[model samples]
Target: MNNIADRYLLHAAFPLSMDNESKSTTEMICIANKKSVQEQQLLQALESSEQRYEIATKITNDGLWEWNLNSNQINYSSRWKSMLGCSNQEIKNSPVEWFARVHQADIEKLRRNLSACGQGDVSQFEMEYSLLHQDGNYRVMSCKCMAIRGTEGKIDRLVGCQTDITRHKQTEARLNYDINYDRLTRLPNRQLFIKNLQELSQIESSCLFGVLCLDLDRFKYINHNFGHQTGDCLLVKIVQKLKSCLRSGDLLARIGGDEFAILLAGFERADYPAEIASQIQQKFSAPIEVENRSILITTSIGIAPLTNINDLEHQESSYSLIEALQNAEIAMHQAKNKGKACSVVFESAAYLQSIAKFKSENELRAAIELEQFELHYQPIIKLADRQLVGFEALVRWQHPDKGMVAPGDFIPLAESTGLIIPIGWWVLRSACAQMVLWQQDRPKSKLAFISVNIAGKQFSQPYAGDIIAQILTETGLDPRCLKLEITESEIIENVNVVLSTAEKLKKLGVQLSMDDFGTGYSSLSYLHCLPVDTLKIDRSFVENIESNIHELELVKTIIKLAQVFNLDVVAEGIEREQQCDRLLELQCEYGQGYLFSKPLSLAEANNLLESVNN
Candidate 1:
């Protein structure tokens, strides 16, 4: 090993410019000495090369290291030790001390990679791992290592470089958090929930998982009345409570505003799931005091147990948690329909039945669009005059298969699906057309108005006013022949729109009436402002008109109140002669019910109108 020179290849050389002079100076030195002039010159050149290499390394903050595997020793570069918040003299220079500072969790992985390097296996010498700083904080380091093998094909020495990457690692972690979590609720969002669910399903062996679909009932009412800030505060409170109800292993997710979902497992019996759901439902039975106001809240829950992840067969290629959640949603709606503050379980057969009902609705909609619906007008006669003065337009669905379905069966469905808009429009047009025809046949008959009921959604549409005006104009019937009836409950929700539309209809010369009075939300302020021409006392009040003297007096009081407002009074559902006679005796201007005739078709109503004049 005497006078060992650098044994390396250098094919190209360029002049180094120093002091404004191009000199053929040596950029690198090679030490070669073997009793030859050339070898001795290389020895001096190699010695000078060391100073330039050290300068470049110091400028870039790059620490260099050499490990001698044969000696079982590891050496750390000065810069590497300095980057760890330490100086060269303050820390040991061996791999043992290096691993000592490494986080305990990452030590095994670092050891595994280092062992591969010792065996001459292909390994990325440069890597990143966390190290404990002098102050006990963690710092990330980027390491580069290259193997130096021996003549016997065994490792001899290894050299590497290390750089600090703590800032970069911190930035990456912050971005990952912002991407995966919800900002407002501070919970794992839909993205993170599905990811966690996927990971959990792979490891769990219980073969049982349940998805609970939780929707806040009347959450919209809170938002509407108290404003969105209060609504958000209430939602935060709800999220905390729902999170508390679940076990540590269970996952709670805020899937949407006013809606949450929970995945539960580790249950011994189906009753366990039911009991948990019941507990959540009952928790909100007490009022939540917010902003000095007591606000009552409740939840509708639908739960579906997943026997296999693929129990939901209708889902697309990547079977998702949302599909199971959707099944839970259908169950929740069923709970709501049965009445809120209850939990409903998923029944596959019953769910199929609901799907079938949905299909029937599509068919019913087609029947409505194709003019397959018919109007049945129930006569409202004067008990004393025995004359038909008006007819209540009852809508009937003439299904191709199920003929003449009554309003009692399909009307509620129509209202729920919002198909009532088109259906109500058809009813108004057809009823008005019939009234015009009836007047044509009996010129001397008492003038009768066709009363049509409007749905709440229909009244809310922006074009409702224009539609009514167009229908009356097209039918060539006096606007007086059409009486537009709206429920009291609907007017309370949208009073301004109701008042504007009612005034517009009145200006067009059509009459307005409030239907089903007193059974709904009791708000009398709308009654004064709604441009109503008649107040049809609901059928329930009329049912006990004779027996219940209180109801009898109430009916007389309604008529007396109407007289003061210059509004006519019509008593609905007058069945018995005594009820009709009582209404007439109370001086009620109009009476309608089964006693006159069950709702008749347009033809029967026309004939009844003919008899009025004869």
Candidate 2:
């Protein structure tokens, strides 16, 4: 038959009633009808497939496009046209039209990527780029493009899809902003400042760039006096003030806390940093008002000029931005020492001092290694009977080069360098071992206990209880006769960890004393919560108890608070006989100071103990 309609028919009269010629014609009709049904089914399946493809493109938010290589013609789907705020009729179906609409800056990259995909070197082309929209604004698009090869093994046509990704682009920009900026002050943070410093220091090697470190002096006082919210407000105002002092290209960043950093990217003279530091000093001369309160604050500035390194390897090593930052910090300390609101330039001597400090740190490590550290015992007397009840174990370092290095000089370095963990363990082990010896030597006399001062860093150590227990086991010291004097601030910081450790210490039968109680802002919560046996009055209060009424009252209040908590009180630094009488009158149970005798060496302590026993 000529067509499907002629090839088949759906119905015919009964075959038996028809003649031979008529029956053949009727059979042909039936075949034609069956073929027609199959043709209809195939057409329906093709329509279904086209509909599914349309749905997929819509669901994926894809804007599809096709190009004919031979004709140099282009076709765009409705979605593709809508994506760029263009009507189908507005945008011509030409390759030139599409290519021209790509962001001017992105066109060359788009061409390169498209060429790569068309060469069959890549399976597909993918990139995020902006496209000029009909609204005269750029819309970000994720373009996925590919080249389809013909049977002749050549590029037949180009195909691609575009997805609107403006929202994603915006999100990425926001994340980038958050990463580089400080939330509190809206200034470049440490990372961003450091990044810029690295770039400048590397490129402008011959140029002098002043790296200034700015720290608000007595900023902690603001936090304690006005609250952190007020402190935050002060920081914002401080940034504004510093930003005013900077040039457009100069960077001012809030590294953290009340600390800020400034980079003077270019300076005509070497003394410009010192000049800038002076200007800053003058700028902060006036008191700043924050949250309805006029807060008096002074800033200390340290300046270090970047050193030049020509070699690439040395650029990365010898002249690191971090080294410049450290130098600035060293200068800042000198400024602080000079006075608040003062500015100091980095001196060569500061570098030498840092070298000395590093040497001291190494010597500390050596001291710990060579067992050059010693424990001196100061007597803790029972004021009621003048009987020696306990001794405070103080760590002393016998440095080979520096002679006797005081703990005040080295303990801070250990804490800063995280050497306190190992050093602290040694102190604990040494104290425990000494206590064991004292107990063994004086079997008749009742040596109640020895108190070892634990640093804030040491108390923060994980598994503090385990360390203490191990030392006790090894030294054979009775846990009952060992008291750990920890600062009250340590008890309040990190409540969960402190609580767990405190509980473990209690279980281990170790007495806990809150050391330097009145010096820190004491919270009643700590006094009520911690398993403390005693409170040692800070020497600052006890040193001037008679002279300063406020200090005297503070001491009395502390004693009363300890009494309410059922904790014993020990007044430290009691040198005068009058101070001892005053402590007795105040019902203070214990006193430790030079009056009882200075911290004695091990042999001297043993002799003193023998004398007391006799």
Candidate 3:
């Protein structure tokens, strides 16, 4: 019987004797019962499995789908239909329904992956793509699929799950934007600019390209006058104006606080970048309105043209895209030095000079570490008696090859690189120690003090007073015997900080001098407030004192002013007897120049001290 229950019942109803036919009938009934039991157990397990799968799909929010290869039909679970913002009846059970919803950009890739998996090239695959939702918007979807094989080891059906990853993708995009763009201006930042530049370097093209480095002139003054919030708002507005000046292919990035860089490409002429830079500057001619205030500003721009690697004469030379940007930056600084609100193009001469400066900077650092420097003393004499009273310590670089490099050649460089701080300290300590030795040698000498020039950077140090005190203690020299010379520009730039530092030094009994007076700011209004012991008339004023009445009168007025302030006057660069006589006529107390002696070595200075004492 087809029905196992019926067969078993019939066997039970009839009484059978011990015969072969009856034995066969009993065996058939037993076999049928066993088969029925196994089928029931399997049906129960399958129902339970379907229930678990339903719960799992709901919990994971994943849409499950199955495809029949033989029938060319697809069966999507209810969750899968909902994922596409569709009801069960609205979607059809066909491959067309799934493929039609995929975005055009991603459809081909999805097809390739599915084809590969079905062909046994890959057992399973996971891919992220975009699918169109019922709302007419595309959503990112992550799909995991596997191929089902038949007994012949041929793939017959594909089963997979789809997860809506639209929100996750949006978050990832936001993070990437934040990383690559500036927060205030919403422009690309330095890192992204560099990455794009590096990528562009790999491209082979005949079209010319270049970079422009820009810096807003005196941006710090704006931040100080207005609040930082206003500064930030102004930067945003400036970015808008800057963007209006660019072509579609050009990129503008804010590389620093007040610094920006532009990458220009596909231009045939070399001067095209300069033309664009001019446009950018012209755009800023009008004042920007920010927080009810009209603020005017200007920009300094530098342009550097990029040369293709193939065009280079030497392939082994060190040239990179980054160096191109650096060259542009150097040109920008040159523009600023030429008095801002201008643009400078990087030339081969400038590039060569930059290479030389870079080499010098490295050598300077080595020289500092190796102590390849010496101090020369220039006598500071009493103008009336031409008597030696003190010596100004001058630092000289004893280059092994160049020999006795000029201070004018390297001092400005040192200041720019901030290497002057350590160099200044070395000069200070050495001068102090040498002064003590001189005092011990000639106890009756009129040599009273040693003067050392202190750079603005060194003077601005918070622990300058402490360092000076330690040096004095180490050298066993009196603080009164050490004079620290600072420039007028340094005092005028940061008045309060300079005054405070000067007060600290005064407390340590160290003398202070305003060096290079009348050359910077020349504001007589703040001169009386300065806590300086001397005012050294600049060399420019002293050089013409002998012939020029105007210069002599200016020096006379300066000396008079010093007398009124009870400050000593030191006239510098007095190369002629007439200049010294004129300075003495102006009642200048001290003078130092070529007429007194050019800077002297230690041995020569000691002999002069001995002669003065004799």
Candidate with top TM-score is 3
Local accuracy of candidate 2 as per-residue lDDT tens digits, 422-541:
888888888888888777877887679989987766776787778888889999988899999888777677556777887998998999998889666656756787888999988888
Which candidate, 2 or 3, would have the higher TM-score against the true structure? 3
Q: What's the TM for model 3?
A: 0.75
Q: Which stretches of candidate 2 lie over 4 Å from their true place?
A: 1-48, 86-92, 115-124, 134-136, 307-319, 355-372, 375-614
Model 3 alpha-carbon drift over 4 Å, by segment: 1-23, 306-321, 358-373, 378-390, 398-406, 417-422, 441-448, 454-476, 479-614
Query: How do the predictions measure up, each by TM-score?
Result: 0.62, 0.58, 0.75
User: Cα lDDT of all candidates, in order?
Assistant: 0.78, 0.82, 0.88
Cα RMSD (Å) between model 2 and the true structure?
Answer: 13.5
lDDT per residue, candidate 3, 26-67, as tens digits?
A: 786886676677666655766688789878877778899988
Colliding pairs, model 1: 5-31, 5-32, 6-31, 29-45, 29-46, 30-42, 30-46, 31-42, 31-43, 32-39
- Model 2 residue 205 lDDT score: 62
- Each model's Cα RMSD: 9.4, 13.5, 6.7
Q: Once model 2 is optimally superposed onto the true structure by TM-score, how far is the C-alpha of residue 555 displaced, in angstroms?
A: 32
| CA lDDT, candidate 3, residue 27 | 85
